[model samples]
Target: MSNEQVISSVKDSYLVEKRRNQMIKGAIVLFKEKGFHRTTTREIAKESGFSIGTLYEYIRTKEDVLFLVCDAIYDQVRNRLESATDWDNPSVAKLEEIVASYFRLMDDMQEEIIIMYQEVKSLKQESREYVIKKERDMVAMLERMFTACLPETIDEQDVSLLANNIFVQGQMWGFRRWMLQKQFTLEEYIERQIHFLKQSLSTDHMQNEKTDQTP
Candidate 1:
């Protein structure tokens, strides 16, 4: 089930989606300005252009809003990444495109990403676990892509690690932008990363080729 479906008190699916979209848009603006702890449910209601009573109809507490925001951010990132690559015909080039697309998406949502990292700690235990599971699912998506594109010798464990590294590398741009932005443009950063990734994967590919010939 979607985050909206899980938390929203609104019984109608269409209404749940509609109201949550408004709430998310408003909550993001407030969360960016005041951080999660300082942002109040009434404020979120006001920001969302809904009455406090109407807002309550959709969510029970401020924590629900935070959960919704975090879930939406992750979903947006995952959806864009999916569109950026063709799983039916995965290739190294497609992998490169996915990385570049993810970095750009992170850059666009840096403030929200920062908010997610900082305020997710305040969520209830179950909500936090749900968010973590979503992240793992994303890493698994990357792992599948790597498995299709990489040579057989790379091994599942290596692909898994590489997939995680690529995901983290994209997030690092958002989390460490103050330092990275000063040093390199987005294109430069992507180019350097692609070079490093290819170097690592190609080394494994070549070693495997040599071993196969030697026997």
Candidate 2:
């Protein structure tokens, strides 16, 4: 389904965008503070500065708001990753840069990220599926970038796993901050992850080279 269907009752494109943004902004604050289960539609409306009736005009249910927040978070992340890197013929160094940028964005949106992981189960099946698909798209994007970086030397499976791991590592900072923050600053975390990732991928490349040389 199209993203416009995320909020269906509204027909005006501009108004739908405007109201959804307002609702998302408000719902995020509530969800972050009270958690999804405890938060009420009334509170979301109040936080968003809209009446209960107005909230319904844009979203059919509170779950819609949750989905919207998750959607926005991904949109922001993908935008940052795409804009910062040279997508065409990206090098391993460029992939590392993307990973570092992703971690920083996660740090900046830590609270929202926390809510996203903790609350995603609350979304209805269809809504959950949509979010999951968007997530897959993101992982696939990274996989493509890494595959391009290494070309014939890197195993596609290795790139796929690394891409998935990179995505999780970024989210881990948000959900595991209480522990991670005690051990490393954001810059340190970013640096170490990139280093570890580079080392791992390089090892795979070297092994691939050895196998080819042996044959």
Count of clashes, each model: 0, 0
**Each model's TM-score, in the order given?**
0.93, 0.93
Model 2, 59-167: lDDT tens per residue? 8888888998989888888788788678665777777777888889989998888888889999889888888988998888888777777657777777788889999
Model 2, position 179: C-alpha lDDT score = 98
Please give, for residues 1-215, the per-residue lDDT of candidate 1 as tens digits. Answer: 37443565668888888988899989999998998988899999899998999999988889888888889888998898789879788888988988889888888888888899999999999899999999998899888888887777888989999989988898888899899999999889989998999999989899888998995
Model 2 global lDDT (CA atoms, 0 to 1): 0.83
Off by over 4 Å in 1: 1-5
CA lDDT scores, all candidates in order = 0.87, 0.83
TM-score result, candidate 1: 0.93
